[model samples]
Target: MSFLAPIPLPAPLTTRALNALRRDIVTTRLAPGETLSEATTAERLNLGKAPIRAALAQLAAEGLVQPVPRRGWIVSLVTVRDIHEVFDLRLLLEPEAARRAAASAQDRAAAAAPERLDAVCRAGYRPEDPASALGFLEANRAFHVAVAELSGNARLARQIGRLLDESTRMLVLGLRRRDRSGEMAHEHRALTAALAAGDAAGAAALMREQVAASRAMVLAALTVPDAATVA
Candidate 1:
């Protein structure tokens, strides 16, 4: 019904800095492949350099930022290849999770999971508003994670969550350019229907279609950027 507890988080200052930097990176405020300086970022965020350093290291580990030798840091550059790889993995995993999730749905609470996540998504996503991207992505992440969890495989659920996190920048890139209209909602609705009907095969097929659509949409969004091209 809700998310599982994550591992121990960083210290408060580090956590704050990490959250701010991650938000900027994922939303393209800190554009992909854009350089970052610890001092500059610390001053911009009105935080200490130590915390910023810690945050950047964390981001690097998460593949959201790249560490440069002698130079400062750069936001990780996303490519079509990267999207292809992530989505390819998702294609292998998510449909199976959906099939299992639908098969496991035997209670009222289980049946309502998709709709609950849909409410969060509908509230957070607004096509005209760039600021809503983060909330929408979080809701989207929740929706996918819930489905994977319902599959009764903790490892699968965790892997799905990580893939969603890795796809954040791509989703934000697409969302910022208004690349997707109503496709996501329609896919989710159909998937939800299949899940509610306890159609395992149907749910799997719908999820596969949804993931493929997302890959295409995000790849299109990559073309809008003036920095390094993705292909």
Candidate 2:
């Protein structure tokens, strides 16, 4: 008689696990203030504790999770102060980067920047469509990152990349309320026009206003939840 045998498990865990966990934390699917235990996660994920621990550490680095000394990890809480400060810093730095990009970008990248930024604006605020909203957000992120790259500043771009990660989380939260995608797109077009004209000052000024406008809109939503639908 042939005996039935159990099927072996899939594959060994690796960085994919870490990345998946990080995405969940950022997207708030895991929820804020929720504690995560390596053993528990390992069991649920059908993996070992080592991989889970390592993933938790990676999440900690991203500020999506906090290590609690002897305790496990807790999901990072979203605070109004954090939201204000993160966007404020973005406002301070990104405009300068945009100016540098506009000043130096002379070929395909120059043309591409404006087009990409315009696309981001057209994406608008899409509350009912989370994936669509994220697409617009990613496009917006690429626009800023493109500016930093065009500026030819590796160090600045790296720092800005880190800031963008944190800012993205806040943005996803804000998206739950309304869609600022259209206004955002308009600002991008204006900035692009300034860039196309090689007006560094004009590009920078417009970028500053654009960033401030985004921050204010997001902050307004956070303060008044009832006003979530307002853009």
Candidate 3:
């Protein structure tokens, strides 16, 4: 007789639940200020309540969800403050990183960079398919992380990865309001070409422009009380 585990293990189950919940929240499928119930989440994910509950706590720590006194959990709101803070850091960090990437990148990496960007752009957002939006978001984040990593600074790369996570919801919400896939693709191509060609100045300039454009899109997609200043 073949031996098999009777039930799903807690650690793997919690990780599975966490990934599902985080993906939904980051994609804005769970939306800002939306309430979540452990039971409902468990049922929806076909997971156990304990794992879902544990996942919620982890998300709460990540600022993606908040615990209510009476209610279960709520997805945290995307604020103007959040957008400004994140973009400010990106403006300070990413262009420098991109410049360094071009400075350090090998000839073979230069050849590969544009091809990588091409693959990523091919998975751009499709209005009819929600999954495609998720694919685009994930691909975009990975591309940024790769750029940072090529910069030859591990710390900077790790920070960029974390910042990308914080920005994913904003990116998805902006996508919902308006698709910028074409512009994004074009910008990415230019940036990648500059990086691969070992043009440090050009890469930095392109990265700055891309970050600025992304900030504008997210701010425009948001409808906070200070609507006039968003422009």
Candidate 4:
């Protein structure tokens, strides 16, 4: 008989549960305003009630979910105002970042800068596969972060990182319709080429156009009638 020592159990349940809930909620799989019950989540995940409760509490802290007075936890609803705020920040930050990336490419001092935008465009084009969206989001972040990092301002980079997180979070929430993903990818590719070619003015112009288009999309999503709102 092979003697086997008792397998050590993994870390505590609550952390595992919290991560699972956060992943599903952030990815839009749970959908905005979707109510979550501890019992149902626990059963569905094969986790204990204690863990599920703990997880929901943490998600509430992240503003991804909220507790109702009498109902239960529901996905947080992002308002039109929220969309405006996110895009407003994007408009303020990204244009300048793109300019810097273009300058860096022109000088040939920033080897990684050019590829950053390329990677983001590549990832965005992979949106047809839902499993790839997370990677796309990560690459998108890396692109913005690269530009900021090459700006030679640590504070600016950190600020850009925080703002980009908020913007991407809202974008991910609103990107429920994958029909237009190809169009978005093309826009990104154009922006990338402008940056890589060391065309500062062109990159800045493209960045402005991209943000403006994004703002329009968000407004339309907020106001236009959709089956998503029919419930």
Output the number of the lDDT-best candidate.
Answer: 3
Which digits, one per residue and each the tens of the lDDT, describe model 1 over residues 1-231? 336867777889999999999878877889887999999999999999999999999999988899998779999889878888899999999999999988877854655676775675564467677676677777777778878888899999999988887787788777766645367766777887888778999999999998888888787767764734455
Q: After superposition, how far is residue 7 of candidate 4 from its true place, in Å?
A: 31
Candidate closer to the true structure by lDDT (higher is better), 1 or 3: 3
Tell me the lDDT of candidate 2: 0.73
Against the true structure, what is each candidate's TM-score?
0.86, 0.78, 0.86, 0.70
- Residue-level error in angstroms, candidate 3, position 77: 0.6
Show model 3 residue runs off by greater than 4 Å.
1-10, 107-111, 128-131, 224-231
For model 3, how does the per-residue alpha-carbon lDDT over 50-92 read when each residue is reduced to its tens digit?
9999999999988899999889998988888889998899999
Q: How far is candidate 3 from the true structure (C-alpha RMSD, Å)?
A: 6.2
lDDT of 3 at 125: 79
**Where is model 4 poorest over a 10-residue stretch in terms of lDDT?**
222-231
Clashes of each: 0, 5, 0, 0
lDDT of each: 0.82, 0.73, 0.84, 0.71
Q: Candidate 2 on 21-123: residue-level lDDT in tens? A: 8767666667667888888888877878888887788778777789998778888876777777788888878888878877876754446666655654565
lDDT of 3: 0.84
Residue 126 CA displacement from its true place in model 4, Å: 7.8
Residue 139 displacement in candidate 2 (angstroms): 1.6
